[model samples]
Target: MATPQIHIVKVQKIYRTANREVHALQDIDLEIYAGEFVTFLGPSGCGKSTLLNAIGGFSLPTSGTLTVDGKAVTKPGPDRGMVFQEYALFPWMTVAQNIEFGMEIQDKPKDFIKTKAEELLTKLQLKDFRDRFPKELSGGMRQRVAIARVLALDPPIMLMDEPFGALDALTRRTLQDELIRIWSEFKKTICFVTHGIEESIYLSDRVVVMTYRPGTVKAIVPIDLPRPRHTTSPEFNELKNILGTMVMEEQSRHQKAELAGTTAD
Candidate 1:
């Protein structure tokens, strides 16, 4: 078999506050092959975001290691593109300018940046909004700009943290389809983090379920359902139910642990 594009080996994360330290992640061993779409799904406070951050090099693990494309990740760079829950766009820049900002920072030639920005705008179906400010656009449009900005860099990997979490149901669904289309067309290795079980199942080749905080991998379920998945289909519901049960079980286990700690204290 070919080597996985992203390899995370026995990773752990610990956060230190004023008086104590908390373990946020434990022994997270994951491998994402090139062109695969994977998602981390769990309830609030799970380490889904942490794991995503670690992979993007926005944060470092306290122990173990993380590698992407055969190199260890120590800090953030243009090689991995990130899309956050918030749009994360510069308010002052127009859509086209924002998309070209990365290339500007890298001092890429003006013509190259312009061409790349236009290409990404076209690819993301945002060509008409190139002159608009982020504030002038709707939430979904702004997110499309955000995604285009990242794609303009031509990164090999994408780390998205609830990229659609803030949109309305209609907009979220629309963006989900757009995302899948983009993923299929580009074949970028993607690790998307979301709390929605159905959303995870719809977008991922495999779903990695995490335990509630002080999180660890509880289960990694392969979603073998046929593509162009339907939300109302019987097979889809069955897979959702199975994953839902596992998530609920993990949540219950975490709640019981919390209650026990309270009692002991």
Candidate 2:
């Protein structure tokens, strides 16, 4: 087998303060191959985003290591691009300028930056909105810009933390389809964090289900369904139920904790 593109080993993360230590993650060891789509699925506080942040070099693990292309992930680097839940775009910059910002930061030649921006705008189907500011665009359009901005640098790995959670179902699925198309074309190793089981089932090659707090991998469910999957098909619904049970277990755990806290109060 080919060596893994992203290697995480024995990863543990603990958040310490003057009063308490919050154990966020433990015993996480995963190898994500090049050009694979993997989704981390779990409930709130399950460390799904925490793990993705660690891989993006935005969060430091209290123990163990995260590496990309044989390099230790100490801080945010271009090799791993991140798309957050929010668009994270500059309010003042136009779409073209926003897309070209990274290239400009790298001091690429003016012509190169312009060409790259045009190419991305065309690819994302935002060519007409090149001069428009983010506020002028709709939610879906803005997200397309956000994704185009990330792809500007051509990172081998894309870390997305619920990038579609805010949009309505129709738009969310539309973006999912757009993302699938983009991933198919570029084949970037994408690690996405989501709570929706069906969304996870639709987008991922494998769904890594996480448990409740101090989270660790509870299960890794492989998805063999074809592209443009029928959400109502027997095969797809069967996998959804299987994944749903695992997720509901954690959710039930959370509810019990909530009820216990209420009783204590």
Candidate 3:
């Protein structure tokens, strides 16, 4: 068997202010295989994003460890790429430049950077808009550029935090298909965070459900359905209902906490 591409063992994260401490994550244990796509599914304030942050090295856990390719992840590095819900493109730069930014920072040859940017622009269906700025593009177009920027870097793992959550339903579905196509071609190990149940089932090889505050893995459901999944189909609906039930249970806990003046996750 291939080695685990991303490993999380007993990971825990705590945030302490001057007074109170928030337990955001607990005992996260997962081994993501190379090229696999996994989604962290939970309601708002759950530790799904926290777990993604840990893997991206954006934040550290108070205990346990997260490793990629046998080495500990201590900081954000080239091996992992991140795509956020917000389009984090540089407003001053054109689409081409934004896509090439990471490569330029790495000091890769100028020709290689330019060539890669062109390839990604074409692949992401943004070749015509290469000269456009973020402000000039629509939400979906901007998001495509955001994803293209990360893709141009060619990281072995992609960490996405609700990258399509803000888009319209049609755009969201379109981008979901686009992302799956990209995943099939590039085969990057993906860890995506989302609260959408159908999105998780449609996109992931496994859905790791997270519980309320002081979140832990509540369940890990394997999505054994075939790709290009039809939401209207019986098999698809069945998977959705099963996963939705698990997710709603945790959401119910979150709602009860709100009534109790407790953690609202």
- Global lDDT of each candidate: 0.89, 0.90, 0.91
Worst 10 residues of 1 by lDDT: 256-265
**Order of candidates by lDDT, top first?**
3, 2, 1
Cα-lDDT of candidate 3: 0.91
- Of 1 and 3, the candidate ahead on TM-score is 3
Q: Give a tens-digit lDDT track for model 3, residues 1-265.
A: 8779898999999988766788899898999999999999998878999999999999988999889999998998867899989988899999999999899898999889988998899999999999988999988999999999998889999999999999999999999999999999998989999999999999999999998888899989998888888888898899889888888888888888888876633
Model 3: runs farther than 4 Å from truth?
none
The C-alpha RMSD of each candidate to the native structure, in angstroms, is: 2.4, 2.0, 1.2
Mind giving the per-residue lDDT tens digits that candidate 2 earns over 114-198?
8889899999999999999999998889999999999999999998999999889999999999999999999899999999999
Indicate the worst ten consecutive residues by lDDT in candidate 2: 256-265
Q: Is candidate 1 or candidate 2 better by lDDT?
A: 2
TM-score of each: 0.94, 0.96, 0.97
Give residue 234's lDDT in candidate 3 (0 to 100): 94
What local lDDT score does residue 64 receive in model 2, on the 0 to 100 scale? 95
> Quick one: best TM-score, which candidate?
3
Worst 10 residues of 3 by lDDT: 256-265
Give the per-residue Cα lDDT of candidate 1 at 16.
81
Query: What are the clashing pairs of model 3?
Result: none
Clashing pairs in 2: none
Query: How much RMSD separates candidate 1 from the native structure?
Result: 2.4
